[model samples]
Target: MLTQLSLPKLQIPFLCHGQFMVRVLVVSQAVAVVLAFAPGVYGDVWARLGFISVFVHWISIITTLCLCAARHKINQLKPISIISVVLCIFLTLTLIVSAVAFSLFSTLFNSINHEMSDFLAKNLMVAFIVALVAVQFLIVHAEKSEQLNAQTHAELNALQARIQPHFLFNTLNTVAELTHIDADAAEKSLLALSALFRAALDVGKLVPLQTELELAKQYLSLEQWRLGRRMNVNWQIPDALPAIQIPALTIQPLLENAIRYGIENSAEVGKLNIFSIESRNALTIVITNPYYQSIKSSGGNGIALDNIRQRLMLQYGSSASLTFGNSEGLYRVKLVIPKS
Candidate 1:
């Protein structure tokens, strides 16, 4: 049996955004200027402009407040329902404001006279047309935004998926090597591997920094078990890790790269160092390992680094960064995560 797929529901723009309100105010003022100069028998154009501006500003402010108030409910409505609801609010407010303006205009500006019915009809018509266009534009913009978000989510998941298999295969190979050498150690490695996988597989867009660090520790323990004295890791983490969220599986892959490229390819004991520098707005993690020039690294391809970079961009936009290079005979990777 085939089932129909459900498309994403339409989302309303946040009407309370400062930029949006500013645009509304500017457009309303422009409209007022145009209306005031519409070839009328006006003695004073400035007076007409002032009157129209006041009227339009009143309508704009009231409409904005009404929409902002009903935004939560309006967002839950279907496309047609949302359009209908917004139009009703706009037309209703415009009519009321138009009536008030007409009464005041007749009393104050005796030179210009507009019948109540004509004024109300004209205001309602304009409100309906403007509201319709605005609603359609907002809906289209939201739909495109939703589609872009969906595409990004799919790409993020694909990148995340790519990382797991590489991690699993590498960890399993290490466990296999350990089993032949020592059974009890292999059992402990399996336990650690289980904990690592649970964190990796069940992770969402972000996890606590502490959790990611723990996962990295588990992975490094498995590697230490396999490599023994060949690999020595020095941790310089703070006693109190910052309460921040980081992308999952971030640190482990960097450590894996260090082990694969820096440690395993070397004959002498390799040194790996992990440390953190904390500031008010950002946390920086630095990983450094020996870079051997003569000995060619067997697995030097940068799949993990590239994957981590893409994931960081998706999560943090441009605020967070991952950078690495060889500095003074040592390869260094630095990851910076913003507190925001």
Candidate 2:
């Protein structure tokens, strides 16, 4: 069954994120600075700034802690419900912090005179306004993020779809040709094709490196059967392949391109080599095949290579790369995947 991609739900900004926390602190300080410089007549500007900073920081820290504690449950709520709950939290925290700070100031600094009711009301009003603005910003950010994700998934699905029909036609043609010579071999090819199709259709964005290697092997097996004496493959994989997640169908498409442009086009037997090198920070896979400059194979427009490159970019950003070029009479394709 084909599963359609769903847009990600709107989520409250996690206070646990360092960036969110830093922004909160910075904004709080900015508010304190603005309050200190406001038109109201104040005794000492620095003292007023300090007092406001302490009060706002207290409210901000407590609110952040409370939200962080309940973030998991809050995230599961509907968007409107999340906003209501978060606003309620902010208002409640503001009231409590204001009451406590007012009592402390009254007790410790008798010179300062402010009514508890007025202070509490002021804090609650400010908190409500700030919370409303922040919530609106978060909602907008989440919506934009969700839309970007949906667009990426759509593009990925389209790119993935492009590969499938090409793969199916080529495999089916090979099987059809094989059926004339050997019925049993054609049946085995069909079974392999079924596994390949299942993996192609069912796989998510990422799969284990070993799984991709297996898929590549299955693809090569089909090609080997079709090409007979002309197809040759060499594997230099590690005994203990690094435990890493790779984009699905990462290797098979490259191998298909290799066979189509290199082995199938060549008159003599072509050597295809697949090897991997693992480093502390990254894993690299290299595929090489005999390159004949004279043989102009049809459909060498590099659709498969481009699809894989886009998928790699979407999956790993700049941390992964796919590069291919003719080097030393062999067409070499190098794929680098970050281990992190």
- Which number leads on TM-score? 2
Instruction: Give the clash count for each candidate.
Output: 0, 0
In the predicted model 1, the residue pairs found to clash are: none
lDDT of each: 0.78, 0.78
lDDT of 1: 0.78
Q: Where in model 2 is the C-alpha error above 4 Å?
A: 1-166, 180-184, 292-301
lDDT of 2 by residue, 317-340 (tens): 567899988867899999999774
| Per-residue C-alpha lDDT of model 1 across residues 226-296, encoded as one tens digit per residue | 78899999999986977887877788878877877788877888999999999987899999998766323
Task: Indicate the residue-level lDDT of 283 in model 1.
Answer: 95
**What's model 1's lDDT at 200?**
62
